[model samples]
Target chain A: MDWHQLWTIISLPDNIPIVGMIFIIPFFTWFGLRQGFANDRLLEKLEGDPKLARAHHRKTQPFQKGWARELPVWPYLLRMEFLAVVIVTFILMVWSITLDAPLEEPANPSLTMNPSKAPWYFLGLQEMLVYFDPWIAGVVMPTLIIIGLIVIPYIDENPLGNGYYTYKQRKFAIWTFIFGFIILWCSMIVIGTLIRGPGWMWFWPGMTWDHNRLIFEINRDLHEIIGITSQPWIGIFGGLVVGGFVTVAGYACHRLIVATEFTRRILGRMSLLQYAILQALLIIMLALPVKILARLLFRIKYVWVTPWFNV
Target chain B: MEASKKAAAKSAPLATNGSNGSRQLLGVTVDPQEIKQKALMDLNAIKQPTKTEVYKSIFRVKHDQTARSRTLGVLSNVFLHLHPARVNRDAVRFSFTWGMGGISFYLFWVLTWTGVLLMFYYHPTKVQAFRDILYLEHDVPFGKLLRNMHRWAAHAMVLTVQLHMFRVFLTGSYKKPRQFNWSVGVILLVLTLLLSFTGYLLPDDQLGFWAVTVGTNMARATPMLGHEGPFGPQFGMTPFNDVRFALLGGSIVDANALLRAYIWHCIAIPGFAATFMIVHFWRVRKDGGISGPNRIMLESEIKPLRR
Candidate 1:
């Protein structure tokens, strides 16, 4: 086929070509002479020559001497992950069996139900929206959280903690990470679960993440006294730039405060533990907003099969 | 002379055979005639410059490179191709720890695939919603697994996307060139959560109904969304007119909500996400792999020629 006809490979779905791969692979293999591989000296040496095989295998053996190479976090994480997956599956199965929620009405296009809530998971965002304007809940906070997440590997791209304690050396970052996670999450959940009612509230009853939306509004009004651009996009972009600048500058300053080698070691140790806790807190926090929103908006409540098992 | 030539020929094919075993790019096709033409054209393009070399020769042969050379680049030489490389291997670890982003992407893949299968069974309406889910779960082969994988993967994507952010924040990856991407990631993350929200509203069960109710209620609460009376405008639209209409598709949440969420979750949000994600990963590689003070690959070591 000509180039125009050939470009169809690009337009075909991801799998269609992959399916072609299953056949095209062997087609090319035989066409290129699959029977020829046997003629290959390397292949003959690998399979037929004992001495060459032995030499090659021996040369590639791992160096046991390096304390570093023995480290194995990937496997460890994989095992732990498997356990988590199994446990979660078992729990879901049990819940599905026991809860046996009524199928309820058939999906009627015209029907409306009260205490209409979102899926329990989304209660967090739906709940957050209660406090902040749609621009904030639907836009700002969720945006910040995910954008913040995607940057993790970039920030700590250091292969330092590849084995176990990834940030074992960065005590300052550990605390900073944990602190941010906890503060952000706990505040969201607390605000979402407690203040929620007909809508969001800023006081104890049922306000959302921006419980103080009007307060922030007042502050913005005050800032306008000087000359702060209050446009949402401008505010968001400006806030990010300012926050990022301050954080980097702050990290540099803090690095100087705990400058000793021993202190540095101590800091690293603390950072790792804090980092782990922060990881947990993040999971909890992520679950919270959606969960609360789901419950509040959809009336779809969650029953942790074993209340304690719930994150 | 004949015996020596045969022996050398046998050895030559060995290396060539090994080289041929490498994985081809996804869209490459190598027909025999095409290969012959391409190889010859490539040979001419790279041939040592002859005595006729002049200003005219500069544009003549070089501009007309064979498709093969363009596909393969100048890396075909053993020395160059072996060392030819890119993307530090360590960069792969920068993903959200539990494979959330990838999982999300994969879920999208699964959803699209299964969604097609589901389309065979599902029609976008209150009538078809529950039956399709039930049929898929009970009737279709591995339908339950497919549905379960889609549902679980969606949830997992949400979790993973969040964790990914947490990782980025702690590591400070969002500082600069990545900031816009981070912003895009955030948009994608919200879209992911939105996808989950919308998808949940599809099955047309109590779970689906109540979920949309609370979702819309929350939507209405935001001054930008929910308002009331004559002046209640959503995101600046006439009250109950614009955003909610777009969200629910009509005046209230019924079949409209289910249908809207399904379309957006299945089509719109994911399409938007995939578009941005391509940009996200490209921007990432542009920014360079994750950097830190003590990366393993960064340490002074035998830099094995490229991978």
Candidate 2:
């Protein structure tokens, strides 16, 4: 293993955030879920004893007979905020002193940067360019992601877990978020930053970036693999395949939404429009991994192709 | 002699009215012993500065340990007033909210101050931008440190904002009354990204130039607006008059693009982002402060759906 090569990538000033993120994301996730699980255990205890539920404060936080439910912002919250500011300033000061921001040679349109990447945050979208057209990856996907996030509260009809963390109470919501944010968005950014090297080729973590390397893999469209050459037939077959995948995926998401009695009750609360939007978003989200798998494992390129676009 | 007699008459009644037995004539009072005692008392009160007129004028409230003073401490100050006078006892715990939102705001302030300082040395023209950065790094006093702080704080802000959103989602803080504020937050998130993207082009270095080139190239495939996008040609879009052109101000990343990015980064987008941030924080207060680490509700207690 080329430990030097791995170190070079990790030690790059711009890559530090992603490296930090690798630990920060999981640490925070575990930190949050730990509280969630603790709340769940408390929830179980309260559910079994209605008398304690009525008398008890119902929060995991310690309480006494006459303690105030709220604290003064002057000394309590303000002190915390002041401490946070000081801590953040210290971190920023040390970071700025130690590491220099990157500045390369003067910009020349004639010379191109091999494997030119966007800011670390946009790397997830840049990575999507490998699997889809720029229109879909760059424009449509970001728009959809923003819209989906905006509509989350309007779409989520479950009322049990409001204002608190509880994995058992918000199993579907929490899992979906983990899958979308932690698994999809963050992992893609990590892959784009560390794994994808010169010429935009995949290099294992410790592998040297060989600029002259070449792979002879041949990728084919789904219709082409099935030997459909005519224009009308190709379009029709591709459409059918895409439609079938959507139908199956939609059915699976529906089944999961109605999996438990609690979920079914939550699902019942959603209006038809809410349900439809949720399913559409879920299907589109699932399509990304499906397409990635198709391209990686089977060397399948486009599943659907037309004069206007390809998917 | 007549004026002196009239002044004495006026002063004699005022002397009787004065509790300290000071004599007054017209607007002037003459009482050496009383004035000396009053001055001594004032000097003594200065030891407790909070009781002084100057401090009270600015603060407009007592600084004693009373509960009223504590509440007014947060409620009366312009900056601190954004926070309510009181909050849930558990909300102050670092584990509850992770304190990411406040950190994100702090970083924004850091970026603003550093960015303003950097701007004093920067010129946005194509000829000067790169050289200015080099000058900043090599010659300007603490310019390198200033720029580094701005850059790192920006990166830090982005991470913290995302984590803040994640925490909000995990705690289900976006439910019910907070739904609209959450939407506002998503817009703020977009603005934050755009702000970072625009700033990336300011240095005019190859790293920034090409990174921007790759980023804006994607806009060229924006379905109906871009020249190369599907049906774009049919709608009369071209390299000279497309969405990408609007973004770059030309067919390629050039002088115009640099100017555009500079304007957006330093002026327009910050203005927009600041406005949205105002709305976001205001709504947070209106929506009942930070959504809690409240008691978890049982599934059996699910309220009936309001048709």
Window of ten residues with lowest summed lDDT in model 2 chain B: B10-19
What local lDDT score does residue A84 receive in model 2, on the 0 to 100 scale?
A: 96
Q: In order, what fnat does every candidate score? A: 0.16, 0.87
- For model 2, give the TM-score of chain B: 0.88
Tens-digit per-residue lDDT, A207-301, candidate 2: 99887889898999999889999888888899999999999999999999999988998888889999999999999999999999999999998
Off by over 4 Å in 1: A1-105, A108-117, A126-183, A186-311, B1-100, B229-239, B290-307
Per-residue lDDT of B146 in model 2: 93
Best of the candidates, lDDT: 2
Interface RMSD of 1: 15.0
lDDT, candidate 1, A1-311, per-residue tens: 23433343223222122233335433432432221222233334544555655554211112234323222222333344445556555744443343322345664435554334454345456655543345446544555556455545344323222211233334444554554454444344433433343324334432223423543222122123334454554455445644554465445544543566634443353445444443443443344444445445553332221111111
lDDT of 1: 0.48
Query: What ranges in model 2 sit over 4 Å off?
Result: B1-46
lDDT of each: 0.48, 0.92
- Scoring each candidate complex against the real one, what DockQ results? 0.09, 0.75
The TM-scores of all predictions, comma-separated, are: 0.46, 0.94
